[model samples]
Target: MEDSTHTGALLVVGAGPGVGMAVARRFGGVPVGLIARDEVRLRAMTETLRLEGRTVASAAADASDPTALRAAIGRIIAELGGIDTACFSPLPPVATIKRAAATDAEDLLTALALVVGGAATTVRAVLPGMLARGSGRLLFTTGSGALHPSPERASPAVYTAAQTAYIDVLRRDLSGRGVAVAHVAVVGPVGADGHRPEDVADALHDLADEGGSTVLHLTEGAR
Candidate 1:
C-alpha cells in the first residue's frame, strides 16, 4: 500500500543474499530497504533487486552498532517513506560460537549487544510509526538454538535464549495494539530439502498477514 504520507516499506536488517534477498523479492510490489555490514553485498543486492524490477534502497551498517544501525534505518525511512515491516536476520558474532569454557565477558557482551540490544534499537527506531499506523510487522529469524541449544556453541545458546525472551516480552507488550511480532525459527540451515529462501520469504508474508505473535519452525520436508 503506497501512501504519500507514509512509506509503508519493508526494512530488512542484515540483508544478505539468502533470506533477506528472498524476503525482499517475495514482497513483490512493496519498496524494500536493505541494511548490511558489507557495502559491496548491499550495493550488489540492491542492484540485483532493482534488476528484478523492485524499488530498493541499501545502507551499510553493522548490526552490533546501535547508533550506526539506527542511523542507517533513519536514512532508509527517509528515502523509502516508512517501514511497514522490519525483519531482523543477523546472527551473533562469530567469536561467540566457541565452546562454553572459552566464552568470556566480552563474548557475552558482544552476543547480547547484537542479538538483544540490536533488536531493541531496530524495533524502537520503527515502533513509533508502526504504533501510529495501528498496523505493522516485527519479524525475527533465529536459529533453533533459541529453543534447543547445542552445548558446544555456548554463546549462540545464550544469545538466542535472550533474543527469544525479548521477542516474547515484546509480543505480549504489543498485544491488541494492531502490531504483529513474529519469530521464525529454523531448525537447520535456511535452505534444506525443498525449502528455498523464497519459501522462507513466503512464510514471512503469511506470518505478517496473520497479524499476531507466533513462531514458525522450519525443517526439511515440512514446508
Candidate 2:
C-alpha cells in the first residue's frame, strides 16, 4: 500500500510487550497513542520512550468495554492530533487448553465474544476517522491459531471462526476507501520462541509500500 499522503499519528489499542511496544517504538519519536488497561505499565513504557526522545502519549481503556474505548480513542485523537493508524492488539485474557473436550462454556463464550465483539468496537470507532482522511492504516494483530484449530488443543471453534470473520469484515468492508486495513498474521508464539514484535512491526510497516484497499495474511501457519 503506497501513498503520497502522510498520517498525523498512530494509535495502538493493546500496548503490550511484543507487537504493541514494537510498533510504538518504530514510530516512537512521532506523535503516537497507547491504549491499554494497565496504566502503570503504560506509564513505564511512556516514560521509557520519552527518555529515548519519543513524543508518545497514552489513554487507558479496555477495548472490551464500548464506552471506555470510545472515550479513550477520543482522548488520543485530542492529544495526538490525529490518528492515521489504529493498531488493535486487544489481548484480553484467553482460555487456552490442552484438549478440545476440556473447554468450558464460560471460557469459550467469553473468548469468542471478546475477540469478535471487541474487533467490531475497535473497527467502528476508528474507521470513521480513517475514511474521512482517505488515507490511514487500521491494523489488527492475529495469530496462526485463527487460521486453524488443532484437535489436540481444547480450543473453541467459535473463537477461531470469529477472528477469521473479523478479519474478513475488514478486508471486504473497506475495499474502496483509501484506508488500509492490515493484519499482523502471526505464525508462532507472540513473544519468545516465535516471530518478535519488532519483526512483526517491520512487516506491518511494509504496508506503507502499497496503500490502497485492504491487506491481510495467515503468514506461516495456515491454522
Candidate 3:
C-alpha cells in the first residue's frame, strides 16, 4: 500500500527498461519524473504510465553529461513540484565493458563518467531540497562487482566501487537527519539466474518506505 503521508514525487534517473521502469511502476502511486537519453523511449514510458492513470513526466538527457542531466532534472522537478525519492540505475553501454588488463584509460574514464559522474550529479541536484525538508530517499542499483570486485568486469567494477563508497559515506553523514540512503547490489544478471526486475523494484520500494541506512546484496530468491 502507498503511504498516505508521503506525497512528494519520485525522480528516476537512467529511466530505461527493466529495473528503471520497474522502479517507476512500483512507485506509480505517486507522481514520477523519468530521465533518460532516448527521447522516444521517454515519451513511450511516460505515455504508458499516464495510460495507467499515473502522474508522470519525462526528459531526455545523457547521464554522462552533467550539464544536460542537471537541466533535465530541473525540468522534472518543476513539472512534479518536488522529489522525495530519487533512484539512480544507469546501465553502461556494452562497448564500455572491458576486462581490467584489457581496459585502457579511455574505457575506464567513459564508464566512470556514466556511472559515478551521473550519480554524483543527480545527488547534488536533489540533495539541497531534501536536506531542507529533513527527509528523502536516495536509492541506487548497482552490480555485485560494487561489493565484490571482478577483474573480468573492470570498468564497471571500479565505478560501482566508487559509487558504493559514496553511498556508504552518505549513509553515515545523513544518519538521523531524516533522509535515508540505500544501495541494492544485484548479485547476478537480471532476467537471468531468476533475478527479476520486479523483485529489485520491490526491494527499493521497501527501502523508500522504511527509511534507514541499508546495503542490500540482492540475489535470486533473496530479498
The sequence of per-residue lDDT tens digits that candidate 2 reaches over residues 8-110 is 7878887876678888766544677888888898888778777876678898877778788888888877887777877777674555544677777776766
Q: Please identify which of the two predictions, 1 or 2, would achieve the higher TM-score against the true structure.
A: 1
Candidate 1 off by > 4 Å: 1-7, 192-195, 211-223
Q: Model 1: what TM-score?
A: 0.90
Where is model 3 more than 4 Å wrong at Cα? 1-5, 209-219
Among residues 3 or more apart in sequence or in different chains, the pairs in candidate 3 whose N, CA or C atoms overlap within 3 Å are none
| lDDT values for all models | 0.81, 0.69, 0.82
If ranked by lDDT, best first, what sequence of candidates would result?
3, 1, 2
Name the candidate that leads on TM-score.
Answer: 3
Give the range of the ten consecutive residues with the poorest summed lDDT in model 2: 209-218
Q: What's model 2's TM-score?
A: 0.84
Model 1: lDDT of residue 193: 53
Worst 10 residues of 3 by lDDT: 214-223
